[model samples]
Target: MNRFLQQPIWRFYDQSISMKYNSPLESFATDDTLCQLVGQLQSPPTIRTWVHDAAVVLGIQDHRLPYVQQGMKVLEARGYHPIVRNSGGLAVALDTGVLNISIVLSEQAEALSIDAGYDVMVALVKALFPEAADKIEAYEIVGSYCPGSYDLSIQGKKFAGISQRRLRQGVAVQIYLCIEGSGAKRAALIRDFYEVSLQGEETKFAYPQIVPSVMASLSELVDASLTVDTVVIRLQQILHDLAHEVHMEPFHDEELTLYSFYLQRVLQRNAKMLEPK
Candidate 1:
């Protein structure tokens, strides 16, 4: 068990239910704000869960695609909004069935190594679904979108991807769990995006060659009927069991001001990234 997971108290916020902060832009901004709050010792370690309707979040490297605009059009045709994220990693698909979790912890006392942060998320996900503990593995799924060292997979099929952000002495370890629907179908979207964007041109960064079959939803992997709501309940239960207390403490008014600042910065950066080249 990771020491970070056993914090004395954790602040819990569930935005997936209300769908109020469902946009990828707002979600990223909120994470940044939480990073600042937690890093400054204004808030305790926080766990946030969220979901977006239909989005394809591109990475910093993704913006360099030769035909990127046309690639975004493909996603838009399928009712998915495409936007670049302020994090490291390639493109990833997000829909109503996907659940996003962020474990924000302060580094005031001790800083977490990059791998340590990822390990904590892996441990939590394993704890969340104990039945699949033996099957779950953390290794890069070659044909999966956003392939990384910490890609969560069953057998050779990936169901989740984790990324991290460090700001203001805080570390936010975030993961998007494909809980329902077709993970391969989502992978197909990214495959198409890359094929169109790359146009067989070589680039400095080696964007993934996504194989749709290499990805599967958690429900698909475990052979169980798992939904976003049920996963949220399970996560809450796990938090309560791990920590002495879990509080549903949302942002204070002052925190809202920080959120707004981050929101604008994210918005501005996204707009700038997508500008005509």
Candidate 2:
């Protein structure tokens, strides 16, 4: 048994229920909020689930594109609002069908290594879909958007990607799972985004040469119709089976107040990221 999958306690938060913080900006802030709390020992190791409607969360590298303004405009035209995130990844499409999970953990004695954080997320995902446990592979899917060593794929098609954020004394391991809808279509959106953002301009950074066919949804890859709700249920069941105690507590007033402060910081950072050059 992987120790990463043997977490004794887990605090669960399902934002998909209220659909309140379903926007990209709110989603990022929510993670930051929980990360700060857990890092401060105000909360336990946490697992949060959220889904945004339509947004493209870009990384710092993507913001430096020669024609980034044009790319943002392109995304806006396509009904996907673009925002640069405080994480390490290129442009990734987010929608109703995509499920985002954040595992926030406190740095007990030593700082968690980056690879260790990613491994935890990978283990969590595999645990969530134990039926397809061996099928999940963590490797960079060449030509996939936001290509990374931890891009989660099955067979040859990529469906999810893991990224980590560390703050204070906490680590937030995040994964965006394409639970439903057309994964190739999402890839195409990023491909077009790069096309518009780069506009034949050369740069020090190497952007991904996205191949839409290489990206797919978990539903398509597993050959089973997995909706966001269905996956959330599976997550709850998995946690229940794996953990000795699963805490599902609503945010208190103090937490909400602290969240507002973190959210404000995120908003300001995003506004600056989206500002015209």
Instruction: Return the lDDT, model 2, position 100.
Output: 91
Residue 120 of candidate 2: its Cα lDDT?
85
The clash numbers for all candidates, in the given order, read: 0, 0
In order, the Cα lDDT scores of the candidates are 0.93, 0.87
Tens digit of per-residue lDDT, candidate 2, span 1-277: 4465556788999987575335677777878888888899898788999888889999999988999999988999999988889988889999888999988988865568899889888888887787788999999999999999999999989999999988878889999999899999999999999999899988999999999999999888885667899999988998888789999976789999988898899999998987888
lDDT tens digits, residues 1-277, model 1? 7788999999998998675336699999999999999999999999999999889999999999999999999999999999899889999999988999999999999989999999999999999999999999999899899999999999999999999999999999999999999999999999999999999998988999889999999999995688999999999999999899999988889999999999999999999999978
The TM-score of candidate 2 is 0.96
Tell me, by lDDT, which candidate is best.
1
How much lDDT does candidate 1 score?
A: 0.93
Residue pairs in collision within model 2 = none
Off by over 4 Å in 1: none
